[model samples]
Target: MSNGNEAGDRLRVGSAPDSWGVWFPEDDQQTPWQRFLDEVSDAGYRWIELGPYGYLPTDPHRLRDELARRELTLSAGTCFTAFHRGDVWEQTWAHVRQVADLTSALGARHVVVIPEMWRDPASGEQLEDRSLGDGSWRALGTGIDRLAKALHEEYGVHLQFHPHADSHVDTQQHVERFLEMTDPELVTLCLDTGHISYCGGDNLELIRKYPDRIGYLHLKQVDPRVLAEVQEQDLPFGPAVRRGVMCEPPQGTPALEPIIEATRGLDADLFAIVEQDLYPCAPDVPLPIAKRTREFLNRCGAGAR
Candidate 1:
């Protein structure tokens, strides 16, 4: 984690190896995980983040072997439904612990948690009963604090909270509140550009406001027109995603200069993971998107930091 002023300040650019990497269901045409590794490697990526959905070996030895065979390093992985609307805390904790063990075995450190929605699954109604306020924040903070301590002491892993569209904590205000309530040392922010922008937030301002808490980054780009449509239609998260509002890196809509500038001097350990929520429609998206993002960042002298 070198500053921009440092002689060697190359911002390591990599692809998030989730659905965006292989296009999930459509990726079935190719061999499971090996083909993904091969394709990404061929596309010129030495590192990749694993999505929750993929052919990842639960066993450490096999996972390490697979990574070695592909010459790829595990940059990070998703902690699915960990904080999401599920009553599987004990189960999720075990699963996350296993992921932590896997990460340690593979020599990676960061785990991204996408919080669950406190909504009704039946009619897609927003649930107001279990909403978090001051008291709930205290309880949530306690839970996260305990979890963070366990992760640090047991596995030496860092927990990065990813605020996402439709999730409980997605907006800039929600992020700020979470940061204010939670233990900064235990829980850090995964500043996702597209999510923030989609929520009508100024990504640069948030980054500047909490530079130290930025644990990792999801370098996504959004289409301004699509964003406009989302707003005009007053579409919720599901419909918005279905309408192709969110997109790949190197935004075809809004300019990404501000984002690059915002992250220019960041010194904390960062994984600028190129995450394009799009996959099924655009199968061969991640490689080119990644290449373009890295080049753009490099041009902006983002690699200087």
Candidate 2:
């Protein structure tokens, strides 16, 4: 189940449930969990992330046995946070604790935290201001810092903040400001290539500017043609994803080879997990695409050689 890559670099390439088109804990449209595990392993990826908390087995023993039999490993878990929204600490922590408990139990040390999107991801309706004010900004910083500390102290996991499309921290400027505002020791960037590019951020530039804070990687690309249309229509992430904004590798923007190369220059080994957002895709669509994307990433020199 190894990527069978040349062993000269520190990049550990993996795929996630997103690449399998799983977005919710239970969904008729998404791939089934057992099939996802079987296909991901068969597709040649050795590592994976828990996309939604309940999408996989929360019972550590059962989940562990499942992954064990497949010869796959857990890299991290995904969680959504809205610290900018006042009075969300308890609610946020409650959610994160559940995710972290499962993440840590599976021996994964990273929790990828996505900021709550300003617009509803499902409905494309504006749910909050696209921009946060000074007060909200301070709250976001404070709340995230506090959460990072708790995740480390309590669950022994690090917080990898993911700047996402339509969220307050989606832009390059927003990411840099967030880096400046938070403590680097506790917080790091997940550096989701597709989302950053979707928000018009530069992947290589961010890597060069803050190499140390780059903790994890989501290796995916944006289809510029689709992106242009998405921008013109002002589509929300869900609709844009449905429209194929996140394209397969070797078919999109911010070429991944250079980005992977830049990450190699860092001091730590990073998980460059493939996460193409394919919500509501056909049941049979993900496996072949997953195989091709895995092959494409290997050609990009993702496997540390």
Candidate 3:
């Protein structure tokens, strides 16, 4: 493994469409796709995620041409699933295989597979039944492994499991159990730093424990005050997100520097994707935030030594 600074040369810093407030369809103020491309490019980001698969061009050639025009390239996209719920194996595979096809065509090799929460985000349900039973665990693990392995063998796309807040697997215990059950060869990890903190999980501790299992990275920052409120009130993921639980890099809590420091000196390419959970912002808000985020990353560890 090379030193952190040496490895930094291969580490490409990219931003996601989440910064432009494109998480869900209900967004009151979604930025136009063309405007997003222009701002991200203007902010000096050469690499970016495809956001939701369809938010950008679905046609592979058109997608590639759009990216090329902006001097930008696509990274992995987020894939939401709930394989633990019922007999959705075939249903799930149809979606996974379809997305894998699009992603591979765009020269991306990773999909951030996250579990869909079972309960209402704003309801007072307390995000219940989040932990799966032994049988569900086995089923979920095997199903993900099968999909991941297939995606890898067939499309050369790695399915990285992302443990999210208010989902089936949220806490350290839940994530650790998941890593224990899933096959490492097929199923890997996409560590979202912000979500880790949002769930009260120790981010650095997790990385030290499972460095190689991490195939993707979502560089987000948690606001401690908002997190405290969320945890205290047992707020659901939906409301928490709308409340702006995540912020720009400098405004986030626990700090990302230590997390970046821990990744130093590894040979693997770090596709560090900046995903700030913003929503319904002014048209002009994201560009400046993106600029500041790029500046923060470059100052810490975005560039080569």
lDDT of each residue in 1-305, candidate 3, tens digit only:
11335434656778888889887534446888888999999998888887776788878999899999999988886778877766888888887776788889989888889888776644536544857888888877877888788888999888889998878788888999999988877887888998888877888888788877877778899888888898898787767877888888878775787777777644467788888877657788899989988887777766622
Candidate 1 per-residue lDDT over residues 1-305, each given as its tens digit: 22242212434556655534343323453235665666666655566776763356667788778778777788776775533333446876887787787777788888887776554322336655435656555656566666777788898888888887766676788888888877887889888888888877777787788888888877777788888998787666655655677665455534465665566567764666667665343556555655666666556545522
**TM-score ranking, best first:** 2, 3, 1
Cα-based TM-score, every candidate: 0.82, 0.96, 0.92
Regions of model 2 farther than 4 Å from truth: 1-8
* Cα displacement (Å) at residue 95, model 2: 1.1
Error of model 2, residue 141, in angstroms: 0.7
Stretches of candidate 1 off by over 4 Å are 1-10, 19-31, 81-88, 118-135, 252-254, 302-305
Better of 1 and 3 by TM-score: 3
Clashes of each: 3, 1, 3
What's the best-to-worst order under lDDT?
Answer: 2, 3, 1
Local distance difference test, each candidate: 0.66, 0.90, 0.80
How much lDDT does candidate 3 score? Answer: 0.80
Pairs that clash in candidate 3: 3-265, 4-264, 4-265
Q: Which candidate model has the greater lDDT, 1 or 3?
A: 3
The TM-score that candidate 3 achieves is: 0.92
